[model samples]
Target: MGFEKAVMVRNSTACAMEWSIELEKALRPKNPGRRIEAIYQIGLRLEQWSGEPEGTMVVYDMFGLVPGEDRLFANTIFLRLADAFQLGNKRDVKSRALALVLFGCWADFAKDSAQIRYLVLSSLVSSNVLEVRASLFATGCFSELADDFSSVVLEMVVNIVTSSETESVVRLAAVRAFAKMGCTFSNANRAFKVS
Candidate 1:
């Protein structure tokens, strides 16, 4: 089904939940290509639903899936993030940013604290502009996971903000993400002081 029609039919919490069941089925194909295609389609559908509250809930549901039971999901996220970092346009960057946020949400739900921390740290040091932007969004989304990685993420954010070699836009994005996470300036100062 087309994304627009599917979204129109599944625009509520209940419908999104039902749609997720179907999505899982689609993602369960034995063929690796099929599984990857299903993930790509879901990403596209998510973009269509981005502005709706139900969309966010669907994202949550996507994260709620058990990674061990479906390793393809994790693989899809990694591939998507890699692709996003390679692209150089605003639209691709935003789409990839959202995908990384989804990945962060999944990691948070899975309690993969190390992966979340590693992703932020790696993104901060990346030379690609789009990757840095995606990293900022991913870190902000990781905070929503409310995992034990907040202090780590906050430290990375402060480092990004303070680094002179970082691009201005990337630094600004990090600052926005830091504020979104409601990090305290005093904590940032203390952390920076000790570093």
Candidate 2:
């Protein structure tokens, strides 16, 4: 194993690419410890500005990596980010939450094209607070695409708003998300509004 790595090191390009792919592996949360570290690192990649309204920094600005930019890898880093976000499992919760919030901020290129609708549905139902908020934020940004499942999301959001069990903060976020999705939700609202 050591000898193989030594030979690969001589090929600088391959070495760099190899390491880049290896680094992408870390983006996946293998456990709780790594998720926290990944969240911090991902946060650093996303910019923050006090000038923005309410000092908000919800979007990712391609940070240091762009989708088509030259980089050392067989696959681009953005694709790796998409995969990490797309995993949508409890172990990958933090990074997925981060990705969810960042989605539609720069480009929707990170979305897994094959399972986008499914991804949207799963995101709405996630138990994590951050995941829920992030999903709402992302859906608001991509309300156009979200039109495909706006009714489903709207129904869930309505439940959240009406449910006494839901926290006030989460209920508020749900209302805001519903408003953002109302482009589709409005036409779909007739059913719920009647009662």
Candidate 3:
């Protein structure tokens, strides 16, 4: 029955609001494992809905359901990911990272790009190299919003790339992030000038 409902929600936006409400209830911090599982399920469903208008509406509705100070539930999701990392559970960590990426994409699509970009930038500058790498991957969500973030993001990425104390993998990730953001900014700027 739950599987059927999940499928229904993905296929149509009519029931998304009620379903999202239930899912949000399950996402409360009372049970960490359950919350993680919920986030994973949301990521899977979001993937299924990718590029569809209905899916976009569903994401927008879900974000609306959450309080604004909650950062569209990003804080809750990241807290769970942080806990998984602290436990050194590689599988859980990867799953949570994927979930974060999905959420970031959804946020960008929902026109909340600035908030998600800032969140990713803050994570990248964290002392933990693992968090930095995860944030670098998440930054891809804001590729289209490069014009809004390019300068600050470029400065931060360059700093990471030049810092000798940074891990090799993180530095590489930062380089890639820089390239992606730089290209996006240049393209956007050219398009604006052309228009």
Candidate 4:
């Protein structure tokens, strides 16, 4: 069953089959509290769309009628989350992080493109600690594919680590990512020193 079918099966007035304007509002930079709430509710809906449940009941669609979950997710979900994150204010870390997690989930199951790497990698430089951490985690989720994020990931991590003013905690995470990328230490040590 596709996302549309799943939504129809649920038949909730709150979650209409059409793309709700509420979802777009939820992705915006304003209203951090409301953003998190909306993303959490969306996650519940997504679980049924993907069919991997954890300690929750799932509605079985015995007949496969709808025909396009992957395309819908790639087109609409990516737009609402990743594209929104790119356009929204970077200070809105809560929404940024939540969007990343949801976007990563969709990318995990879809036949993703390099376009997504740009979306995820852009989050690496976020001044907000939580957003950067979320981006790093999401990066890991996608790195398992043959996407080849090494240069971009390593370069960003290297810049972060080599920055004299970067927070110790964030620097540590960057170093971890740098290591995971399997790049040599000397390469990162050669940063242009933007101070």
Two-way lDDT contest, 2 vs 3, winner: 3
lDDT of 4 by residue, 1-195 (tens): 687766555432223234345677666646667767877777666655556432222332322223344344335655665566667666667877887777656656432655557767877877788888777666656654433565446567667787898888877866655555533453444333421
Considering summed lDDT, which 10 consecutive residues are worst modelled in model 2?
A: 49-58
Score every model by TM-score: 0.51, 0.57, 0.61, 0.63
Candidate 3 lDDT tens digits, 26-61: 555456677667767766655554535533444546
User: Residues 1-195, candidate 2, lDDT per residue (tens digit)?
Assistant: 997664333232223344445547666546755655654554444333111222112211212333322232323544555566665456556667676665545224433343444554577777777777777666656554545455555666777778887777777877777776645446466427832
Per-residue lDDT over 99-140 for candidate 1, one digit per residue giving the tens place of the 0 to 100 score: 455565455443354544565567666667876887787777
Q: Model 4 scores what on Cα lDDT?
A: 0.60
Scored by lDDT, the top model is 4
Q: Which stretches of candidate 3 lie over 4 Å from their true place?
A: 1-12, 51-99, 110-113, 184-195
Preferred candidate (lDDT higher): 3 or 4 = 4
Clashes of each: 0, 0, 0, 0
- Kindly report which residue stretches of model 4 are placed more than 4 angstroms away from their true locations once superposed: 1-22, 28-30, 51-64, 109-115, 162-164, 175-195
- How much lDDT does each candidate structure score? 0.56, 0.54, 0.56, 0.60
TM-score of candidate 1 against the unseen true structure: 0.51
